[model samples]
Target chain A: MATKRAQKMEETRAKLIRAAREAFASKGYAAASMDELTAEAGLTRGALYHNFGGKQGLMQAVVDQIDQEMVERMLVAQARAASRWEGLLEEGVAYIEMALEPEVQRIMLLDGPAVLGDPSQWPNQNACLLRTTQTIQALIDEGTVKPVDAEAAARLINGAALNAALWIAAADEPHAVLPKAVEAFRQLATGLLQTEG
Target chain B: MATKRAQKMEETRAKLIRAAREAFASKGYAAASMDELTAEAGLTRGALYHNFGGKQGLMQAVVDQIDQEMVERMLVAQARAASRWEGLLEEGVAYIEMALEPEVQRIMLLDGPAVLGDPSQWPNQNACLLRTTQTIQALIDEGTVKPVDAEAAARLINGAALNAALWIAAADEPHAVLPKAVEAFRQLATGLLQTEG
Candidate 1:
């Protein structure tokens, strides 16, 4: 349905993003060289600029790609859980666990927030937030979760998971830190659950 | 007894910190000019460099001062509470409330983390974390809180509070968003409580 020129432009954009992601994940945003990434993609600096504005723009695109992948993985984790509540908890834990991966830790967790303003304000994060908020509302309706504001609960829950991942990512011994973070995350999420008094 | 030279140096350091704080609070870290700050402080660039290394160093010093003050204020709020549990909740709410202040929001919540890396790794936060861990341990020992890793719980709780402050700081209508954040925080903290059978 598209012209050859338009299709080529799309290919160029994907190539640039793929190249940038590898460079960023390997050497970090600040340290990665733009010239090298463009060369790796078989493109020019002008192409990079025209396609992404600059390094920051490219970083955002790379982060968005990784973040979108993270959401999909989390959704799959949620779907695999035995119940909705379990799914929510599983998703949060999966997010924390994903920090163990070098790519996720380097790009998405550490460099992403520092390069971009706030994770909450990211366009990709909005979809994740919307889904989480809807789940919280449904849980509240089912009397599984408390009657607290659904969006508020979702933000706090997501904030907790996000910080935990950041913690794991920055730790010297991430493997050693993983269990404690996962456990604390589980305990924190329980606060939203409705207790049979 | 201190020498007159040392006394003068101390005064100079204090002057630079004060000047830098006002500039950073108003113009943010990136836009705030070091030249203007030093000029306003009645000091030279050499003096700022000698006292705090440079602009980033000065920002760190300013953040440390503000963060220490925040901790003291939160402690005061906790001490005013009727019970330890109430104090804990009050302290978190007080933290979120402080984000409304322009000075605190700009310096500590926004620019601080972006420039200085994670807040959990900050030296000033170490003191807060220590106190929080101790409180969580005490509450668990007294059967007022669930049996969870004290440091882990403290990190998650502090993380939630920190992110909530960041959220408030960046929100368009922070005042309207304040109540939801505080209430959700209260609910989250309740997750750590030891419910009666």
Candidate 2:
């Protein structure tokens, strides 16, 4: 039936994404072999072409999947913080820290931007942007953050964090670079805070 | 004479770069025809390969040329400011403003990043980064900026401006988006300033 076919197709898509993610993480996008990935997924090339359109398309899907996971992880980090303002800061810092992970450093930070264009412009990021904007708006309402344009502040905050990660990943010594990046990110973000009377 | 030949070669290189810049600015990197660009320069594809590797190499040269010009313009903006800290702010704002220019938006901001990878990793950016880092160190010494890692602060500030420009360029209403981005940028930068006792 139609329901069974839909479930089967979903399984096929998930399998392809998982295989492609592993290949991309290990070998990188440029060297990642499509034929090998398809075989690893136990699917044919036709299935890959039909589901994801081709290699670049598969890369996009993998990037999206990874990005979604990153966002979820960030949310968890934010939740653990004691205050909303602290949570926002933690979220930004978490993004910078994730750059230390090899899979994240390679796939999301390096290969993703080179292949898929700007992550900010990606459809998946709009969700993250909206969420950040609302959080910033709330901070502004409570006099915790300066009354700058919420969306604008969100964009700059997000941009700063994203670029810091890129800087860390590309650096010769990522571990040494991580603390500097995280500290700078926190300092830069404090500009949004309302000055205490 | 060898001197005359060397001069002629430099002229050929300049002509080729000029033609390619025009082509890239007008039609973008991918759309611009290499044959037409060489013809426009009164050279051959062979000359292009000789001086630069090919289209990509030529693009690098063009990007370098533009990036150098942009840095010079930013310095001029900085020099016009009342103080060094003000100059730094002016330089960042000037960078954002330049995104409004069509050639910058098309060739440098869009096509250049897509083709050449992250601008931060570009060899030419090191010069700019060093200069910015030195300026930041000066600010820290003067107690104008807080005691943070100057290089890290410099990277975050530069990244914020660059990403802001990218955001503005990609927006449907760039003109309307400009003020918001500029304000957010100014607000975000204030975080690094030493808090008044």
Candidate 3:
């Protein structure tokens, strides 16, 4: 199904995405120049335009790539946990920890939301939300979580986790602040557990 | 202590801050022009730099002003509620409601964070968090809430409310989405109540 020309196009797109990631990681979206990005990819301006509409397009492509990587990393962390509930907690905590990484912080959490608007509105950005939602739904089905809306819980938890991450990343002593974030997250999450039900 | 010159300088500062707020609220931080902003304030470029440093500084001032307004609005909402718990809930929900306003959405949430970085890091932005933290601390002292770390709880709640507001603001049907966000927020906050503890 793949012709040589199509294959070449695919390779070019991938190269541009890689280059854009480095640019975003270093100079951020605003400062990352178009000429610099194109040159970094070992491609011409025409190739850049043909693949992505322009700077914003390439920036979004870079974001999607980073988002996918973040999700994969989260899934890996989730998989390592021993129980579903623990796994879910691990996932939330992991989300906060991931925010500590410079690339994820600079690209996904900061520049991505700033440039692209709310991440929830993005089609591809839903992977993390959907995953969190499904986990909550499964917990509810098992009567572990209370009889609350799964999607609602997911949104609240995800929102809290994200904010905690932002707080920790910007904290003067991140190592000192992290445990506090996790403990508070666990306590808030407890509100929806099956105790009342 | 009450010199006319000092009073005039203060007025000039307030006027410039007001003008900057309108510029940022209308055009966002990046697109707002320095020349346009100073002219709108009926002042000169020298005044802007002399008072606020530059565009970034002026924008931070705008954000600080908006942050103060938002916190004052929250305090007023809290005062209106029947109980401390009710007041706290009102304050949280009101925060979500505030996100619906375009000015708050544009300047306080989106551009404010995008330009000034994490609002939590700002000197004056802590009023909201401090207010929430104090409320949580009072509730915990009285056993209205669990034994969770007060500051942690505040950060998590603030984060959730912020994210929920952003979600609702960008939703296709904000009215419909508002209920979902509030209901979800209620459930998450309830998880930390004394009953659960």
Candidate 4:
């Protein structure tokens, strides 16, 4: 009975977060009202206050949740690949795919920066950059990539990947962007890492 | 005598655009006011009206001017390079460098998207994309780059470049980002294009 109640509570919390994400993404942080958010979540204002403290707290939670989800997705994509170059390529493609998902697009690219004010200071950016740098270092150590500075390479790749996501999100035809970007990324990766043709 | 007068007027117009660019870049579009802009330019409201029709018109002119400057700079960088690969690398570096510049950072990355509504419909985006596509196609046709879909590659590169610029603009240490990004770009580009080690 306790377990079932816990699960239900968790689901409710998730529902609230999802509703808040949509509200913030569409209206921006400054413009979105707490009343509207609670109504959308189908929860009472008191419940929201008890759960999240306030709007800033809710926004932080949304960012944290999205960042965790992105990391997990990236790890899965990297692990599934056969070669280091292939892994990197798949990772890039996976990022674009994730960005194209409506919820992810709305929360991560559009609303996250818009609400956060200064994107460089966002916790998600630092976490993402650290993860990316570590990945690049691993690729270099494995001899899958060139002996260039891994930190620098990671920053560039992360920047590129993030940009690709944002562009895909902003475009009218988001679906069409990934294949082309993936192809270029594959070629770019192979050229940078492989010893010879 | 008339030609001299016309030249003087053009110089004044350029001064107004430069001042507006600085204002828009630093203050953002919504926060920046015409009174402040004129003050920054050392001109009165009467002069401002004579030069640009109003704030919206001035913003549009600023966008147009920046767009033209970026295109010209890119072309110049491409022209100065000794090889196609080098040119591409230089172009990437130049782009990051330009992004670090205070005015370019402010106008292009921040104010452009913030005030411009949807970028897809922006005439500047269309022209820029078209030019980029043509450039990539030419390089591919010349056997400078590997045989691939030029349009797709162009979009990917352009997207990456734009993102790098945006990141740098937002970063606390804007100067440090491009060197790393450009190095990574060099590796990526080399991997994509070069036929031999």
Model 1, which residues run further than 4 Å from truth? A22-44, B31-33, B40-44
DockQ of each: 0.53, 0.55, 0.71, 0.33
Q: Order the numbered candidates by DockQ, best leading.
A: 3, 2, 1, 4
Cα lDDT tens digits for candidate 1, B1-197: 99999999999999999998899888877678888889998978999988878877888888888888887888998999999999888888887788778898677766776667667788676566667788889889999999988877887887788778777767888788889889999988988988777
What lDDT does the true structure give each of the candidates?
0.82, 0.84, 0.84, 0.69
What is candidate 3's local distance difference test score? 0.84
Q: Is candidate 3 or candidate 4 better by DockQ?
A: 3
lDDT of 2 by residue, A44-155 (tens): 8999999989888998888888888888888998899999998888888888888667787678766765566666778686556666888899999999998988988887
lDDT of model 1, residue A139 = 92
Model 1: per-residue Cα lDDT over A1-197, one tens digit each: 89999999889999999999899888877678999999999988899999889998988888888778877888999999999999999888887788678787677666766567667788676566667888889899999998998877887887788777777777888888888988888888888889777
Give model 3's DockQ, 2 decimals.
0.71
Off by over 4 Å in 4: A1-16, A27-35, A38-60, A114-120, A166-173, A194-197, B1-20, B30-61, B114-121, B126-128, B163-178, B194-197
For candidate 2, report its TM-score.
0.88
Shift of residue A112 alpha carbon in model 3, Å: 1.6
Query: Native contacts recovered, in order, as a fraction for each?
Result: 0.49, 0.63, 0.75, 0.41
Q: Which of the two candidates, 1 or 2, achieves a greater lDDT against the reference?
A: 2
lDDT of 2 at A151: 83
- Which candidate do you rate higher for TM-score, 1 or 3? 3
- Segments of candidate 3 deviating more than 4 angstroms: A1-4, A43-46, B1-11, B42-46, B195-197
What TM-scores do the predictions have? 0.89, 0.88, 0.90, 0.76
Worst 10 residues of 3 chain A by lDDT: A188-197
Give the docking tier of candidate 2: medium
Candidate 1 at A180: error in angstroms? Answer: 2.2
Candidate 2, superposed: residue stretches over 4 Å from native: A1-4, A22-45, A102-107, A110-117, B22-42, B105-117
